[model samples]
Target: MAKKSSVFICGNCTYQTSQWIGKCPECEEWNTFEEQLQGKTPTSNHLAIKQLEKERPKLLDEIDINQEIRTSTGINEFDRVLGGGLVKGSLILVGGEPGIGKSTLLTKVLGNLSQRDVENRVLYISGEESTSQIASRMRRLGIENNQNMFIYHEKDLENIFAEIKIIKPKFLVVDSIQTTLSPELQSAPGTISQVREVTFEIMNLSKNQGITSFIIGHITKEGAIAGPKILEHMVDTVIYFEGDQNGYYRLLRGIKNRFGDSNEVGIFEMTGAGLMEVSNPSEYFLDDHENEGHGRCTTCILEGTRPLFVEIQALVVENKFGNSRRTTQGFDNNRLSMLIAVIEKYFGISLSFFDVYVNVAGGMKLLSRESDLCIIAAVLSSYFNKSLDSRTVWIGEVGLTGEVRSTPRMDIRLRSIQQLSYKKIITSKKNLESKEILVNNLAVNNISELKNIFD
Candidate 1:
């Protein structure tokens, strides 16, 4: 008998190898190779013809491209994150940690859309939950299963396609791609090969039928979505549900989108009834310790297209360990260290032997330089024991020489604060006070002017 040829596969990236290797050459993941079925020949590609048949010939001049009309969900926060509304024929992928409310969010979207008085129908297919469970959730969501909405409980791909054809829903949602299995492939659900095949099949359905489909996926222990990177590459948009399980807030971030900017995000606070859209993040970011004492200050950090005022609180105490203990929450620790060094070098603030801890209240992230001045001021306030004004909001970047610098999109930031009924805002003089710029009831400029206004 001839020696049979074997195929080795990397469980991490789904890369195949002819022989066994300790490390996967494609994804560089070590000890991730597993011996799949030994094949004398490559598996036939079913998707190649699907792709070939789907392409339509069109000339650049002949093709009519109109401005995109976004279909709003009537939820301002959701629309804001989605860059106005859902684009027709857009395939969206939502992935996240287990029990992170991925299914709940999609259910809410379907329920709201079904409530609209339109002729278009919507389909909600669940591979994870039962039909009865979906019915229960719909009732809880204040939605009754009506003619506009169709609920399905299935894991088989062929039947899913058959149902899609009969119904011809305007929008579609696959509750989870991991639980879905294809009969052609003899792999278990949630496995890398299975997930890839299942998702690719749905992507084809979305493209060929002009149905906007949302396929939900699960994350691995390392936080990356399970299956090959090819799965993410296949989708038109990728979104992730993020936040600690113990926390009350959930963050919806767009990691990739073909129709809109990928940086935008939505915040929702988990409530007794359901997830509530956080219209004004500043209300949660800034705490009531405003009238209490020092060690805390307000700062604005720009997230995608939205400007937000978050509180930066610090506590500086004499270090018992001598080397100083520095810790931060909702703020980057390494960046905090660099800012502390800059403050000490520029303003002669001795922080070598002090224990420093920084936190952004309400557990929201701060990713920009606008919080630099606020962190410095908060640290100083802790050391000097001076309480900052409750009505004031500060937004500026602090340079190495103690000079406050300007940030991008100052107009948006000030407008957000003004709309929130805030009375005072302190920013870089150069950015806001330009002779060509104009706004109403705006005051406070530069760090020097801010200090003077405070006294």
Candidate 2:
């Protein structure tokens, strides 16, 4: 006989407590705790222990290393984000907001794989959609169904596993993990416990059977993957499909990867046909150059192995109200405030009574700290009612003392900019001193030196 009791679990962080509380201690989220009936704990560790006992540990030198096996989904952008391609026996999780093209992208990948692989054994199990709905989408995506690609509409974890065993699929995709539930678990499908257990079972299956699995997940209102934080930790790779619903461009960012680089990103554009890969993201982000007027400047950022050139625009208006508003889009708000303060302190430009607004073009978020110089230049150009040279590019980190510091991968960044045929590159003097740099470079030691160049 086993004991059962009631427990309160936080949906955001999986913090379990005997009593319900207003706030979660781990995540500090309010009203996220849900009461659920706890079932008897399973003594399954004995089996795992016995299985581990049979395996022998080998020295690093003794183990033979083979070429990592990868299956390209035929979507170059998707494959690039998956670190060259999908690895054998890897469990991948994809999360995004509704209508962000998570399903469309994966469906296209499956379709491509079906066409490429002669013995395509890809099973797409959907818990939320009916077979008809999926078929309709496949038609819209121009995916002609193959004999090997199977679709099953089921939500029961056991039933899904049974189908997997029978189909013996080389690749599996669960439309979503939240909708799948086990019969034995008393909790609802999307509960923390249910999500955690369901994911663990699927993970075990993928590892043991050497089947690659892609699990779709929903994000909470907080923009994090729904369910417990532990769910993200258990997967081999975690990818977030992000884009502005109104915009056609989409970014697939890999936040975690056990086998490859974690910061890899793939760019895509939504079209009538399907999710199309944007091979030249630079052209997409910097398509417009006619509006090189005051408050606009160009900058380069490194996204994984690729360097991207994007325009930064700023607007500084005299504030009518007592409190001036500081707004930023695709740029950090705190970083903007810091830049404004640096300008006021060092350059003697008082932005206290001016409303400052900054935006990074193309709906792309600016994550690089090196974008500081470009931002400052844009702000100054807007404040002084002057425009920077259209052919100039800014690259440097701004410190508190208004000194321009060298950024990492300076050589790589400069090479990318030079390839674009930019007339002048502005950065710290150290960059110009490097003999490897082969570009027309402008050296600026501090904010004062930077202002003099434009003046």
Candidate 3:
């Protein structure tokens, strides 16, 4: 006999309570608690205990080290973000806003995989779309129907598992984890218990069968995965696909990875043909139109191992209202305010009544501290109504005392700038003295030195 009881679970963090509450104590999210029926099955517990009994602990030295095998998806940008290539038995969760090209990118990867080996079995299980609809998208992505690639439109977890057992696919893609349901659970498909159980089962399948799996997930209004936070923790890698709906570019960022470096980003352009990789992201992000302005400046930030040069644009205007507005896109608002205060304190610039707006070109977010100097330069240029040299690149972190600090991997940043044939590099004096690279370098120890550069 199974014992069943009603429980309240937080949708955001999967926090469980005996009764419903207005807000979740774990995640601090309001109105996220949902009532659900939880059942305890003794059979599952027995199975788990039996499974654990079959495994024995061994010494670390006793284990044999084998070379890691990685299969390329035939996309360089995608492979770079996946840490060289796709690792077998790895579970990957891909989350994004609707229509952000999560399905399209994976479809293209599957198409490429199908082309590589006609015998390799790849299974795509879609709970949201019909088989014909997926085929239509495959044709749009120029994927021809092949015997190796199979699509099964089903939402039942048992049926999906049955298909997987029959096919024994080397690779598996679940279009979405939310719509798949287990008959054993009384709650809806996207509930906390359902999602957690499904993910746990999928992980077990991947690890036991050595099948690489990619699970597509939907994001919430808060820009996080819609299901419980525990869903992200169970996967081997988590990737977020980001871009503006109206924009032509899309960015694939790796948020967590067990086999590769996290925070790796893959740049792509969404076109009629499909998602095309932007090889030279620096050249792609920096356009000539962005350079023909007073408030615009160039800066380089490393994305994973690749150095990308991006343009920072700032605008300063008189604030008719009492409270000056500070607006920014792809840049931190708090950092912008701090930089504005630094400019006012160090340079004695009266920008208290001016509204400041800063933007990082190409819809790319600037997370590195190295872009601090470039942001300051852009702000000052806009305030003074004087344009800085477009050929000059800024690379340094700004301190509270208005002193420039050296950033990490200064040598790599300098070499990248030099390769692009930039005329002058402005960085901390420490970086210039430490590196012997022969490039026209401008050493700036303090923020006040910037006042004389544009003059």
Candidate 4:
């Protein structure tokens, strides 16, 4: 028998060392190293290599192009984030904070897949919860009639694989990868070594067996998947649930996808039944009945291919004490500061002495630069205590010189605004020159012109 060796690994980046270090040189993270006992390496198999030698590499033209078959999870919003639908033999990793509806959403997905084909078998393996607990939750989700769905409560990797080999389910859901342990390793579950090994085995199983698999993962406090970075690289797609657990809305954002666009987003509302898709996210996000007041404005942004209208609100208050603070939610603080400088320089508004607060309604994070104009409008409205047209939408990016810049997909944004029956739009003059629009267009070349709109 070969003697076992011990090695230290970084939990964050999976950097390995013979000796434990206080800080990891690879990821620059401190105190993330954990020790693991490694077993003896297995001898190489000459027969397997001889079998591989029989296959020859082929040219790209030699490969046949066929339309990939996609199985819908019976959730439109989930399918949207998945680039249309789940592809066969694909390994998907879903990560989120605890109690953020990761299991609920995936449970619903299993139920949906089971209902699609009575002959097909779908399995749900849980490491954290009991089968009865999951069944009760499924009942609450109104998924009581899934005859083809099977649930197993097991954490041992060997037993799980044994069952997978016996059942040979078309779709598989692992409630979580952290709690699933490999008996071959001495490291505890959720450790870097165990996580990497478990994911590797599952990936091979999915690819070799043509099984569609979903693995639920826990996220760290820093809002990243709680495993080695290689865990994400090993999967076909990575999706994250974004929103406060207490909040009613959740946004599923695709981080990586090999088969489809990775920028796609899916919106869901947590309800008594389960996660219900929000068909019209624009209508759900915009508050139509609220009185138009200072510090509030509307803007349109594109998430993947979908256009959404979001409300931007700002509050400016005179700071009596220490330093003026700039606070924001769902908007970048550095960008807000730059926009404020532009407003003060071009509009001649002194906001340095005032504390500024900006927020995006409906808990939606604004990544698009097109919301810059709406944010500026909101801040100016709040500072001057004036209200702009409630039916108007602002869309444009602000340059350092205070020029309103054009944004991509302006036509799609305009059409969405018109669909919502918005009365007016304030954007760059360049965006208005080529097309005929139904609503009123308030085109401006510089931030100076925004003062006239506020007045």
Q: What are the clashing pairs of model 1?
A: none
Tell me the deviation in Å of residue 105 in model 2: 0.7
Tens-digit per-residue lDDT, 134-200, candidate 2:
9889989887757778899999987888788788888889989999987768888888888988888
Global local distance difference test of model 2: 0.86
Better of 1 and 3 by lDDT: 3
TM-score of each model, in listed order? 0.87, 0.94, 0.94, 0.93
In the range 1-455, model 3's lDDT, one tens digit per residue, is: 85768999998777889998998898898999888987653245222122333557889999998888999999999998899899999999999999989999999998888878966789999999999999999999888858788999998877888888789889999989999876767788888888887888788778877889999999989899988888999999999999998999999999999999988899999999889999888877887843467799999898887788899999999998869999999999999999999999989878889999999989999877889999999988888788877878988999999999988877788888778778888889988875776668888889998778656
lDDT of all the models against the reference?
0.76, 0.86, 0.87, 0.88
Against the correct fold, how does model 2 do in TM-score? Answer: 0.94
Candidate number achieving the greatest TM-score relative to the actual structure = 3
The residue ranges of model 1 lying beyond 4 angstroms of the native Cα positions read 1-14, 18-24, 27-56, 399-403, 421-429, 433-455
**Model 4 lDDT at residue 83:** 89
RMSD of each: 3.7, 2.6, 2.5, 2.8
Worst 10 residues of 2 by lDDT: 44-53
Q: How close is candidate 3 to the true structure, as a TM-score?
A: 0.94
Residue lDDT tens for model 4, 4-109: 7899989878889999999999999998888888764323322112122344789999999889999888899999999889999999999998988999999889
Any runs in candidate 3 off by more than 4 Å, and if so which?
A: 1-5, 27-29, 42-53, 289-291
Q: Backbone clashes per model, in order?
A: 0, 0, 0, 0
Error of 1 at 135 (Å): 1.5
Runs off by more than 4 Å, candidate 4: 1-5, 29-31, 41-62
